[model samples]
Target: MTTQSIKVTIKRGPDGQGAFDVPAHDNQTVLDVVSWVQQNADPTLSYRFACRVGMCGSCAMMVNGVPRWTCRTHISKVIKDGAVTIAPLRNLPVIKDLVVDMDPFFDKWVEAEGVHHGSLTRHDPIAPVDETSATRVEANAGIECINCSVCYAACDTVAGNPDYLGPAALQRAWTLLNDAKDEGRGAILDAVSGSGGCHNCHSIGSCTTYCPNDLDPMSAIAGLKRETTKSFFRRGR
Candidate 1:
């Protein structure tokens, strides 16, 4: 065991004075140490967690200046010399301690027009799709996202522009576009092509790297851009 105590600084409140420190433990993750502080060190500690397995995007937070899912982040790997800092994810208003309101994060989904507008009702016959089709394969991995905004927090574009749809929404739009049967493709493209749309992304690939699911939203955004460009030329943009 490393004989070093990882220093963990956490945002305690809304006040500018909101700050607290905790020592690290050997083989401990940021989440584990935070849980330790909340359980034994500080009773007033507040944070969010579900499925401690990293499958749920609920436990994302700023660790050592980067947004990460605490459950999967090991303190030994992140904290330097037994030093660490924790806080709610950035680009979102803090509720308290370590929890940030997710309404805005999810609100972007609707804002992106992520919902499919296909006329095919649930009662309609299920259209046959080639499982091995390129588009289906493209849609496969992206559909696995659990709605965690780690990518959102890690995105500098979202930080720069609040109205930007962020990675997840564009990824969802890409998924719908790949559906081939969805009727909302044009609207999705148009919505994302405008201000705060898919065009806003600077393509830094932060969303690709931080994604827990290994999905590349940059690629999805690229796909949207290509589709938008094709339509743009067809319509004289």
Candidate 2:
């Protein structure tokens, strides 16, 4: 049997870059390539992955200059010229090879008030919500985000404006805003209405284009814009 090989180049921060020739197999994923390089070629290689099945976005990286979940990206789909390049996600500080500091991305999540502030406590009764309601539908649209930072890495707004809250955080805000049991609507609006808020988005649609889960953050940002406008008028400011 003949062995098939592929060239894999990885950007190693502070240690320069490394390239390896690895055996390739059919139905292989980008994460598989990375893992092969780490195990067989270079044990020093550092990366992140969990639930290689793709539910967890921890394996997200830059594959051919695009942010993607390595676990979900098939090598056959992204291989170019019999080679592939892997790098840490962009729009965030690189912690090491193929690893980025996620603090900024998550800090903006807090800034966007992504957490659910419940209107009721354990002592209170469960709130009945109509599943078919417009608010519920809108909220459910963006509630599946796993905070993998793929969308944030793909966002041009965050690349230009360091203070800009990226798509994931803003999308979470949009989800929480429509939650009938949430009591932080006003706070969420205030967070996304500032200088580094959703208005700063250029509507490049990169977030939606790169989302691994197919979530439409562009629409969420647009909803924030409309709601903020209404909020402004309500404040009479």
My TM-score estimates for the predictions, one after another, are 0.92, 0.97
Give candidate 2's root-mean-square deviation (CA, Å): 1.6
Over the stretch 99-154, how does candidate 2's per-residue lDDT look in tens digits? 88999999999999999997678999899999899999999999899999999999
Which candidate leads the pack in lDDT?
2
- After TM-score superposition, the amount by which residue 185's alpha carbon in candidate 1 deviates from its true location, in angstroms, is 1.1
User: Alpha-carbon error at 209 in model 1, in Å?
Assistant: 1.3
Model 1: which ten-residue window has the lowest total lDDT? Answer: 15-24
Q: Residues 49-162, candidate 1, lDDT per residue (tens digit)?
A: 988888887999898779899999887678676567787888888888788988998888887778867777889998888879999888775899888888998899999999
Q: Which candidate is the best by TM-score?
A: 2
Regions of model 1 farther than 4 Å from truth: 16-26
Worst 10 residues of 2 by lDDT: 1-10
Question: What's the residue-level lDDT of 180 in candidate 1?
Answer: 65
Off by over 4 Å in 2: 1-3
